[model samples]
Target chain A: MRHALILLGVLMAGMGLSVEAGLLGPLGEQVGHLSATLSIFMVGALLLSLALVFAPKRQLGALFKQPRWLLTGGILGPVYVIVLTLATPLVGVGMTMVGILCGQVAASVAIDHFGWLGSEQRKVDGYRIGALAMILAALWLM
Target chain B: MLLPLIFILLLVGGAVLAAQSSINGRLGAKAGVIESSWLTFVIGAVLTFLLMFFFEPAQQATLFSVPKWQLTGALFGVVYMLAIVFAVPRVGTAAATVAVISGQLLMSLLIDHFGWLSNAVRPLDASRYIAMALLIGAIGLIYLSHQQRHRRLASQPS
Candidate 1:
């Protein structure tokens, strides 16, 4: 039951990304991709911080107390955005999206299979391999 | 040289993106989801500001000048951040990523077909239709495997 909801939520997240892709394109055309990306983060951070003010106070200090490696996740946010900014012009959007899916499939499967990054261990069984193959074929077809 | 470099970079970008969310999911388990997402945006805002200052060229128009609808796109990033942080640990990273990717594929196709956001009109082709079907099949297979695996785990004595 809970799993179904999470699946739905993530799907919505994906939809949001698609909207972002469409919207960002125009902004990138107006301003360079880097500037557009900065604009995005600036607005998001401002809005989220504003929202946070009224919400329950977080144990934000606890975040700093955690291992340093964990901090890298936040840093990766800009890395991914900057990468997209740089790569989009070299390769078209379609190819870039395919490359992203390929990398995501490989990493997600491997990370979970090995229980990397403290994720739960799930074996890479035949079904997953089949799914991966199908995803690859889909990308190829695309 | 440039083609291969960009290809490798895009691949790295994808890995970084998926891995970041998974790691953040763990962080979300420790910190609250909103706080975890907030951390990314805060860090991201500062980092991108520096990059933009040094690297980005002057813009024709600022954010405020763009069509208001375009600005709304930024809000969706927040939704994605919160959702991924909430979903990754619960659904497992693979399932969450696949689900999100599937959604992207579908929505992107629609956006292309309709030329939404003033993008050039690019109608979907036969290959795209087939790709969509294959993605759905892949999702179905992954979901079943995930469910079966969890059921077995749940039945076992902890």
Candidate 2:
């Protein structure tokens, strides 16, 4: 039951990204503004901060102390959101996503194989490489 | 016209960055999802603000003018962050992502084909369908490979 909830949460999150990608990508174009994306991030940040402050006391500092890891992850948020917003207007959301997915799949292979940045190192084999090739071909055809 | 394309590329680049960050978030989130998410947004906000400052000052506005409809993205972001954190522990990232991509493609088709929102383009034709099919196939292939890897791991003796 707990596991199912977690899976549901993850699916919801992925769906959220997809929806945002579709909506914000076009929204940026419609409003002639990219700042809204930033604003949204700020709002989300504010909301999260407030939640943390009001929650029961915990050793949050331990996580913050790992600046290398936190910073590395912290920086990607805006970059991904901004780039996604930029891509939507140019190539259309679908094509832009196609390109992003291709990059993501390729990177996933490397990330899993190398276990770079403290990830669990998984073996990379022919199937993985073939899958990457297939994605690239699909993107090209699309 | 080109401006929109430029923005779209920026968003895609942001997605790559977010993916990498997500790994970090997983490692760091012992503190709390809210904490991790907050820190990430703070860093991202600063970086984006600086980027906006240099490249396109004209587009940057001193006062934020919130559009009636633009707030929808914020709502979506909230749902997205919560969903991501929730999904990771359950179905594993690959399967969760498959669901995401599929959902996005379907929603995107509707948005594009019907022009549900004002100013969205309506592209309903053979080309669009072909593109959608290729994308779906690609997503399926990726999922299949991931499942294969999982099965192999399960079969292997530790």
Instruction: Judging by lDDT against the true structure, name the best candidate.
Output: 1
Candidate 1 lDDT score at position A7? 78
Write model 1 residue lDDT over A107-135, tens digit each, in one string. 88888889999998888888788888887
lDDT of candidates 1 onward, in order: 0.82, 0.57
Model 2 spans > 4 angstroms off: A1-11, A22-34, A54-59, A81-97, A124-142, B1-15, B18-22, B52-56, B59-64, B86-99, B119-157
Residue A24 of model 1, lDDT score = 82
Error of 1 at B147 (Å): 1.2
What is the alpha-carbon interface RMSD for each candidate?
1.5, 4.6
lDDT, model 1, position B32: 78
Q: DockQ, per-model, please?
A: 0.73, 0.40
Indicate the worst ten consecutive residues by lDDT in candidate 1 chain A. A51-60
* A108: Cα error in model 1, Å: 1.3
How many clashing residue pairs appear in each of the predictions shown?
0, 26
**Candidate 1: which docking quality band?**
medium
